[model samples]
Target: MAVQDGPHQASPRKEPGCLRGLVALVVFVGIIYAIWWFTGGRDGDDEASSTPSVSASATGDRGGSSGEWKAGDCGGPDPDRAPDGYEAYDCGDPDATFRALKIMDGSILPAAVQCPAGTDVIIEVSMNSGSDVKPSGGIPTDTVCGRNLSGDHPGDAGAGGGQLVKGDCVTADVEEIACDQAGPGDLKVLGLVDAGSARCPSGTTDPIRLTIVVGRPYDTVCGREP
Candidate 1:
């Protein structure tokens, strides 16, 4: 005798929890992006990156000038020597030499030091008077060094490390900041009101003159200007 057919079973539908999980995942990502936007996306917190880029070539001071100012390499023997009427700070580690930038009477002078070829560094410039800098203009070039490191030698004093604002740390590299026109290896031009401008926009030296605290890796040296 033939057996009777059993009742047909219905296929199980997909669980509702799976759909809920997908929705939750999307919501989580949205929340994270919202937080980042509110925080100004990390680097955007400072004026260095936020500051507008302009041509320094107008100064006509092109390359390192002899009469108006003097330039010296940092991280060399006697890195502690401060230029006239200025002070020095130890911005580098024990294994490396420290360099300082001296500003006096609205003029910037370099304190010489010999740093490694690929060392990242930071240079801070502050007017002792907290004055707004009205940049006259100069050649927009890579870090103009006391000794020109162009062509093949790679010892151009131009800027070799990234740019740090006030208190960030860095690890400079030779090829990294070497010939680049901006960022770590880019040339440093004075007269522009970087951070001090917020305090003394009118342009009068109160006490500070561009103090560049070069931490090896320029980016870490200067904290983003909040």
Candidate 2:
């Protein structure tokens, strides 16, 4: 069986990697993504509360909060329910009520919304996303966090948005470069490409198989291309 093609999207080529202090760039299907620097605003406890960290605060408001908090808020301990009125931090501290990493586009929501399964997305809100952005004009809304492309990698993962991915090419950066060497600053995932909505062609057979075109780019990188 031939390897099915996914989104044909390709990341834009930027300068070589490995420059400190330079903002990163990720190219996918021609779209470029910068860093994930949106700040979640101040925590919302009016009174004193426990200091909130990414982990501890993430679980506090799974149910959701009113628009009282914007996109960047993290919740502190429930002052009314706790033995002490104040959470770890007094009211007014950024994390006192909300711990913001970045602000998002949209109105505040009453509850946290979850992205559906098989969604072609990169970022999952580790903390609460204060506002829920609707599918503006019917575009669909996914957490815009996974914009950054870092961490240990399998070189290649399953296809997304119908794009066949492998190591670095698996990223929108399909071009050849010394990613392991580190230059153009750390790479980020621009977006998915080769977007074939249907995993298999219409009236196709089962057990869909895919192949990495030999002699294509990434054939020699890491010495493991098929």
Candidate 3:
């Protein structure tokens, strides 16, 4: 006698619960991004990545001289911000060094240049800045300069580290408002320039060969513009 065939069976049904679990996972990820966007986290990142190529701080403007920067104006790169912002300081202040003479034209920055007459010190800077956060073969990756590190203050000075606004009486030695707000000895901070001391735009002169201590003052040159 021939053997009989076995009974056919239906395929197992798919689990509805498993399908719902996958949908929940996607929803959880969406919520996370929404929170980051609302808390100002997204804006900060955009400024860094989308920030304009680079510009020397002439006046108060980001790029292109706005006349905010003057011959006697001084300040250093802001260590606190990414693509560091510049701040202004009183003349002869220790924290303030670089003085704006005038804007020069050229893709290649001059190694040394004279400042306008009557100006004393020069804080020359250069760096190859593009979209890269890190300086490449000739680009600069960082631009922080000053007495202490970011988030730190020289408590001995009495004044904390911050951007000095115009009219704030500051010390000529840069003890930073440690003394009285007024006196013949003190000068008022005009505006801030937080762009220097970092990497320069492409074609910037080499700091070593061109001179200038990155962000520190350049005492040798005077009375000419780059």
TM-score of each predicted structure versus truth: 0.17, 0.19, 0.21
lDDT of 2 by residue, 32-142 (tens): 211111232334231111111221112233224522222333444344534212122323555453233333332122112222222222222222333532211112122
lDDT score, candidate 3: 0.33
Residue-wise C-alpha lDDT for candidate 3, range 139-207, written one tens digit per residue: 322222223223343222223222222223344333235334445555443322233433333332221
Alpha-carbon runs more than 4 Å astray in model 1: 1-70, 73-96, 100-119, 128-226
Candidate 2 deviates by what RMSD?
21.7
Q: Considering TM-score, where higher is better, how would the candidates rank from best to worst?
A: 3, 2, 1
TM-score of candidate 1 against the unseen true structure:
0.17
lDDT of 1 by residue, 103-203 (tens): 12221211222223322332222222223211322211222222212233323233333332221221222122323444532222222233533333332
**Per-candidate clash tally:** 74, 55, 14
